[model samples]
Target chain A: MAGSDGSNGSKEKSNDFANELPSYNAENMQSNMKVIYYSRTFMSIIGGVIAGILGFTGLMGFVFYFLVMAITSAGIAAKAGFSVHLYFDSWNLIILDGFLGGLMSFVLFWTFAYDIVHIF
Target chain B: MAEDLVLDTAIRDWVLIPLSVVMVLIGVLRHFVSKLMRTSSQLPDPKIVKEGQVIIRARNLRAAANFIPLKSFRARKVYYSNEENGLLFVPKGQAQNAQAQMFSDPNMAMDMMKKNLSMIIPQTLTFAWVNFFFSGFVAAKIPFPLTQRFRSMLQNGIDLSTVDVSYVSSRSWYFLNLFGLRGLFSLILGEENATDDTQRMMQMGGFGFDPSKSLSAEKDGLDILQHEWALPKFEQRAETVLRKLVS
Candidate 1:
């Protein structure tokens, strides 16, 4: 209902502000989670390739490094939105992905070593 | 003694062949397992802006300058490297503002710096990757035996004057070409260039946009010369235009 006194401008401004809030927040949250997810996945593959090249030495050093980087990157991504839940979720995903990546590398390297030693 | 040596060689070959097969099998199996279990997700939109948004507004600046819109405007800042005498573009926005103010507050500044740095990391990495790959290709094309020995000797310890210029010439051309581009960027952003490469680039861009002086906000009304043409049969035409721009 239009006010007779023409207070409509202020009311419209307030309503516009209210409407803008949710979308902006939503967009930021979505983008942050998206980046965190992608970073974890990409970093995992890079970690795998590195692990393959360097073997046990990579396992001891670089694997842990990848984990740390993934986790930190995830945190940075999550903080971009100021969303607590998104931040927590991103952190969880990063840490889990990192551990899995490390485990995978460990198994791969071990199997490779075994195969090489036994094949001869 | 000959018979003993033959037997030793036979044993080594037998062992190595089987080992190589087993290693391949193990590697493939591990790859499958990792593929099955690994969880990956898409990266969030870099809260930072993308490079396409940067205002690299010079026609034929790289190649096919005509295709690039003259009216097209994008916001960017040019970062000049004193040591390399190079320029890199940064997107314009609140991000650049935050970066310019980094030293005032260490904690806040560092956080902002990290985000801005991350955005450009991909570009620099791509550049490095291409440079190294190109260098490797050039290195591999040298004729073998004599050339290989020559290369190795040069690598081990050779004076710059003693090395073949052909090996260095092509790459240096590439360097100068890109340097001209950086110079164009400096001109566009109205930054003064204290580097020789930027000066040469400015001379080539037809702007005579002196890096020594403050770049004017008004368009210099000159064409740019791209050193390489991605399109077919256009190289000569492009070179002609480039020559005119520099001349």
Candidate 2:
């Protein structure tokens, strides 16, 4: 029992989860996530509108949507002053987090604008 | 690609724009209405707070034990885990059952009912309204091509299988906007807006938060923590730095 207990404590010590900082404030991380979420959503809506107005169809429309998303990711990094370690857990977090989640809004608005300007 | 069908532009003014506009307006209205209905979070019982604090105190002691003298560390550890008066001894069968606690608190159940009413009432009303008025006709065309599999989903309420799968019926468009407008709500009402159905669904699926479970987990963590002073290594490094500076 004592040996098992010792091993449990050792396992916790070996789990290198701190990532450069000794501790991360939970409140700050949540607030950062909210900020990124808002910006990403807003940008995707704009992207969809642009794609629709430009009369992009099929796979090309989807590609343009991602292109807009990529720009938004870069904008976030720039907004953070590029010392992303201080604000975010990792680069992938700011880049890829919620990237696909915004697709629903993108498609909804894209189709709306497409039908409005191009079709009718 | 040249075989494009002409749609009446009047439908855009009447059906499409009005549907989108009404949905957004209803969303904004729902957000404020629910905000008005929300009860302020009541404070947890003092006894629970103190018990939780005891666990935190033990954890802090464990983390900083090496900084204190060995005698002091031993004294604190004994005070926490001693066989007689130890704070960590949750007596056998005395462990808290979270479900029972939830039932015992009448206010929790009331709050949950109020939340459900706020979500369900508006949702049902809006869905009924959309279904009544916007059941027939194609609302808009999808900007991308879809397989035949998407026909049932995208072309709901319309029976014309000969029409392309890219065409969305009015009712299907309403469904699409219902889920898709989540981002728009966040943009409009800020984070944790009350109109989010997905957030409510997630809340229902996750188990209730139990304070006692966290308290016991913290106690176990504190119990297993081992202390080894690193001040001696810091002292060695300081000496080496001083020697280098002098040379």
Candidate 3:
């Protein structure tokens, strides 16, 4: 909460330290996001299709979705060689970014394949 | 959960498969059609580009201002938001109406018209096609149980209050495939595909970008931004980290 007026008022700070902090490229960050999005979306679509083929119903289907997503996270982490920061901006990006966005498509395909294989 | 709706397997072969296939095919067709229709956009006005870039530079300065020296940050801030020649300042006539500019440029108008045509035509055609042939039957049932509020949503064309909310009508199935196949499309077409109606809807809302409006907004942001040099704090933190590592 203190300012430059604290104890270091008279100290003339050096400005060359900007190089010390890590800087990220916007384009590279976006590329990482797109990769993660797909990794999640593609995996979830496969999970939904499998769930449908297996005739998972109600809460069981949701649980399967989470389980599938967990596997996806593990796969991504493994693919990244456990250094998530090297490929993604943060741990959250790898674990959670595309999880919810894939849900709608998952439900759609789930119902479609389920109806075809199990129901009408 | 009453499980009494018996759907014919024939309906699966006919309605479910055909509807989903048609939707996917139409999506691919629309993507190709729109890509074919998209004209190469001309370069924006030099003045607008200058204004836009200045704003972006100011934004960058504001975000990274703490990393730079306090004196340099103050100099840059004044250079951007200064009353005399600040980059963010839009002199009276400089803030011209974007609509007037849009009308003045026939090429811009034509490009927007083409975009609108590509977006609207396929949507109207698919909606009409779905409503025409598949308007009365419940096509498929969702695996999840939704509340009664979802009845109207899941059963758009079929008007049977006796039916469960999970049983989707053909028209509603079209909609479900409409939104739900976004991931599949991305898988098939990759990112920035033309088949995305949602992004086009957002684009249709704003016909053209207005540099002056953004300039004024960026001006306010830069004006309020207080620059505090954070390097000193970071230096101390880094020293502590190094000390811990070395010890």
Per TM-score, the best of the predicted structures is 3
Tell me how each candidate scores on DockQ against the true complex. 0.01, 0.54, 0.52
Cα-based lDDT at residue B14, candidate 1: 38
Native contacts conserved, per model: 0.00, 0.86, 0.84
Instruction: Tell me the whole-model lDDT of each prediction, alpha carbons only.
Output: 0.34, 0.76, 0.78
Model 1 has fnat of 0.00
- lDDT of candidate 1 over B1-247, digit per residue (tens): 1221112333224332333343333333433433333223234224212221221332223223333343321211112211222132222341233234345446544533443444345336534643453332222111111344444432322235444422222233233223323322222222332223234444633322122111222123221222321234356767987999999
**lDDT per residue (tens digit) for residues A1-120 in model 1:** 001121111111223233332212333444444444344434443443454344433235444455546555555444434333323333454445344433333333332332233322
Estimate candidate 3's alpha-carbon lDDT, on a 0 to 1 scale: 0.78
lDDT of 3 by residue, B76-102 (tens): 888888888887887988666877877
Stronger candidate by DockQ (1 vs 2): 2
Quality class of the docking in candidate 3, CAPRI style: medium
Give the number of the best model, judged by lDDT.
Answer: 3
When only chain A is evaluated, what TM-score does every model earn?
0.40, 0.81, 0.79
Q: Write the number of the candidate with greater TM-score, choosing between 1 and 3.
A: 3
| Best-to-worst lDDT order | 3, 2, 1
